[model samples]
Target: MEGILNILKPPGMTSHDVVDFIRKIYNTRKVGHTGTLDPDAAGVLPVCVGGATKFVSYLVEQDKRYRFEITFGFSTDTLDKSGKIIKSGPVRFLKEKELRQVLREFEGKIKQIPPIYSAKKIKGKKLYEYAREGKIIDIPPIEVTIYNIDLVEYESPYQVLIDVKCSKGTYVRALVRDICEKLNMPGYMSMLIRTEVGAFRIEDAYTLEEIKEKKPSLQPIDKFIKLPSVHLNKIEAEKILKGQFISNRHSIETSFLKLYDNNGKFLGIGVSERNKIRPKRLL
Candidate 1:
């Protein structure tokens, strides 16, 4: 049960709900999801089980790829179709050339203010909790990298489909809102599907029913973590397990390295900063 399960979260269930479902099936308390997907969003959601739960931070930080639809003419409280309409205005749909030009402007690093109805925490409570109470709070913008954002297709006059590849913590709904403002038109996200998250792809994801019926036949934790593997002898492996810093003759400059025993047992993740391997966690 100590591995990663790429769950195809249906639109109706929250990320927590999927985690709970896994927990009940496995009857383990250590199960957790790498990131949260809004209830209205259906796509790849990596679930960590057993010792894999300790590496949630690493998975959460990985970049994501999504295919989302941005619908023009109105804005919502949640910035998505799931929320109530907060404002409406004349619809001004942009042509493919104009939309492509506008999308190019977000190809690099940019600052983005998260939507008010989000899971981001203020103090100890989620920001969405405040929004539910009809409270307005200023959430500052943070630097996020949008590696690629291209106009995929336009299904209708008001709906523009886009494919986005961005770093972690990026809100596609908020991105739609920003792009709408750039076009001098208000909009909200109509549909969203996360295609990838790091090495996890949507194609490998399983529906809740499929998982419950098949049980856990998921990939190992190491599959979810993309790192260079370094084989270690018994002596080095013991040292690594004890959380001792080990120096190797061969120097490879990488932020982290995968430590494995002679038997090729996936030990855990380790940092190789300053030519010293300091073990971070033990699997």
Candidate 2:
């Protein structure tokens, strides 16, 4: 109950809904999800429980991989099929060469504007709230890195399937919108499935039914987080637990390190700065 659960969130249930379900299952209020996945989308959602909740931010910042379908001939207010159609046109087929070229343009760092009907916040309010109230707000474009995009399949003049590996905050729906604009056609995300998030993959995810029957095998925090680690002696471990800064002889290059004791017990996380390691979060 104090570790992470790789839950396969089915479509139609919001991320918060999954968190609430896990809270009820474990009967603990300390459960939380790493990030939000669209209700209309299904895939891997990592839920943290008890002490694991303290490391949720680390999981949120990890890279994600997704497989999605972009349907041509229409654009929606939400940039996905769940929203009302805002525009439509006759579907036009693009050659595989042309599609590949267009996808290449999206690779690397690019500026992207998130869809209006999204969870993004503006002026202390979620952007979707303003959209629902019939208000128009200038949404600024953010720089996001698309690590790689591969064309998985193209079905005639209607749908193009793609696999995308991108940095955090990269919205696949927005990428579809931009690709359609470049192709001079209307399009919207028809289907989306997040295959991976950070080190968590869909293959290891558990369905709700499976979770109800058997308790999820919780992963150790040190194993889930990708960070350098430092093993300390009993004296050093005691110092860390007391919130004292210890000498950093390990010379870890990262800003943070997974801390462990002499007997190999996980000791939460430690912050490394200059040549000192200080307690960041102690379990």
lDDT of each: 0.87, 0.92
TM-score of each: 0.92, 0.96
C-alpha positional error of residue 21 in candidate 2 after TM-score superposition, expressed in Å? 1.3
- Model 2, span 39-156: residue lDDT tens: 9999999999888999898789999999999999889999998999999998877899999999999999999998888889999999999999999999999999999999999998
**Candidate 1's error at 48, in angstroms?**
1.1
Q: Can you tell me which runs of candidate 1 are displaced by over 4 Å?
A: 123-125, 273-276
Over all chains combined, what TM-score does candidate 2 have?
0.96
Per-residue lDDT value at 150 in model 2: 95
Backbone clash count for every predicted candidate, in the order shown: 0, 0
In model 2, what lDDT does residue 239 have? 97
What does candidate 1's lDDT look like per residue over 1-283, in tens digits? 5888998999989999998899998889999898888899999999998988988877788999999998888999889998899899998655788889999999999999988888888778788998889888878798899999988898657888899999998988889988998998889999999999998899988888988898957578887677788888898899999989888644868888778899998999888878678898889
